[model samples]
Target: MKRVDVAYVLLFDEQHEKVLMVKNKGANSSYYTLPGGAVEAGETLEEAAIREVKEETGVDIEIGGLSTVSEAFFEERGHHALFFTFTGKIVGGKIEILFPDEIEEIKWMEIDEAETYMYIPEKLNGYVKTNISIPYILRGNVIDKG
Candidate 1:
C-alpha cells in the first residue's frame, strides 16, 4: 500500500468559540475540513502544518501540540494515510483562500457547527470540545469490512 502523511491545524478564535475551516472543492463534491494538507517530502509534520495552513487559508500558525493521530486504510485504492492534527495559534496573516482551485471558501465556524461538518467527526470529538493532554488515536479502514 502507498503511505501518505497529512497534517492539519485547529485554530480557534481568541474566545475559543470558533475554528478556522476550509471548504475544499473535490471532484465529486465539496466538503469542509480543517486548514491543512499532505506533508511534502523531507518536511516535518509541524512544518507541513504551517505551510499547508498558509497555502490553503493564508493564515500563519504556531503549532501548540499534537491533538490527534488518525490512520485509515483504503483497501481498494491500496493506500494508507496517517493524519496528524495539531492545535495552533494564529501568529500572523489574515484569512484568505490562497488557492482558489483547491479551496472554495474559508470560514470561522462555530464549534458545534464544525463538529457536524467536519469530514471525520469521530477523530475530532476528543479535542474539539475538551482539550485532552494525550493525542486521541483512531485506527480503522475507510470502508466497512462487515
Candidate 2:
C-alpha cells in the first residue's frame, strides 16, 4: 500500500480578482502553484495550511471555509496525497518571498492569467468563473479495495 499525506490549496485576494500563488523550485522548476505544502506531524489541516502559506509566502491569512479536496498519486514515487483546498484572506504582514529554495516566486494572478500557468490543475480552472463555493474531494487514479 502507498502512503497517504494531507495538504491544502489556498485562494486569497478577491479584491484584486487574483489568487496568491508560488513558483516551486527544483526539478519541476518554473511550475507555479498555490502556496501550500504537506501537513506536518500532529498538526490539524487548517494549522498546516496557515503554516505552509506563511512559511512559503511570508503572509498571515485568515483561513476561510473548505473549498475542495483532491487526491494526487505519484506512480513513480509510490505515494499519494490527499489535499484540502481552502479560501483564505490576508490578515497581516506584507507578502514577501520567504522560502527561496521551496518557492522561487510569489505573485498575484487574475483568473484569466492563471490559465497560462502550467501548475493550475484542469478541474480547478472552472471554479474561477462559476463562483460556486463547495467542498470537493477528489480521489486519485488508483482504486481502493476497501
Candidate 3:
C-alpha cells in the first residue's frame, strides 16, 4: 500500500480582483501556488489550513467552508494525496515570507491570471472557473489496498 497525506491550498483575497499565492519550493520551485501544506495527525482539515497559511505566509486567516476536493496519485513519487480545499479570509498579521525554504515569494495576482501559474493544480482550475472569488478544497486519492 502507498502512503497517503492531506494538504490544503489556501487562496487569500486582497479585497480586489487579485488573490495571494506563493512560489513553491523544491523540484517545482519555479511555479507559483497557494500557501498550504500537509495535515498533521490529530488535526482537523480546517485547523491544518489555518496553521499552514500562517506558517507559510505569516498571515492569520479565518477558514471558511469547503469548496472542493480532489484525489491525486503521484506515480513517480509512489505517494497519494487527498487535498481538502477551504475558503479563507485574511484576518490579521503582516504579510511576510515565513517559510523561505518551502516558498520563494508571495504574490497577488488577478483571479484570471491565476491559471498562468504552473503549479495551480488541474483540480483547482475547475473550481476557479465556477466561483470567481472563493477558496476551494481538493481531496485527493486514497491508497488502494490489495
TM-score top scorer: 1
Worst 10 residues of 2 by lDDT: 137-146
True lDDT of residue 90, candidate 1: 90
| lDDT tens digits, residue span 1-146, model 3 | 37565655446464546767887877844767677778888876767888888988898887766555667788987878776666567889978987788788888877767755524566666445444333333365322111
Is candidate 1 or 2 superior in TM-score?
1
lDDT of 2 by residue, 83-140 (tens): 6666666778788987777788898887667645524477667565443345322243
Lowest lDDT 10-residue stretch of candidate 3: 137-146
For every model shown, what is its TM-score relative to the native structure? 0.83, 0.77, 0.75
**Candidate 1, superposed: residue stretches over 4 Å from native:** 119-126, 133-146
Model 1 backbone overlap count: 0
Best by lDDT: 1
Say which prediction, candidate 2 or candidate 3, comes out ahead on lDDT. Answer: 2
Model 3 segments beyond 4 Å from truth? 1-3, 9-16, 116-146
Q: Which ten residues in a row have the lowest lDDT in candidate 1?
A: 137-146
Instruction: Please give the CA lDDT of all the candidate structures.
Output: 0.79, 0.68, 0.67
Among residues 3 or more apart in sequence or in different chains, the pairs in candidate 2 whose N, CA or C atoms overlap within 3 Å are: 69-136
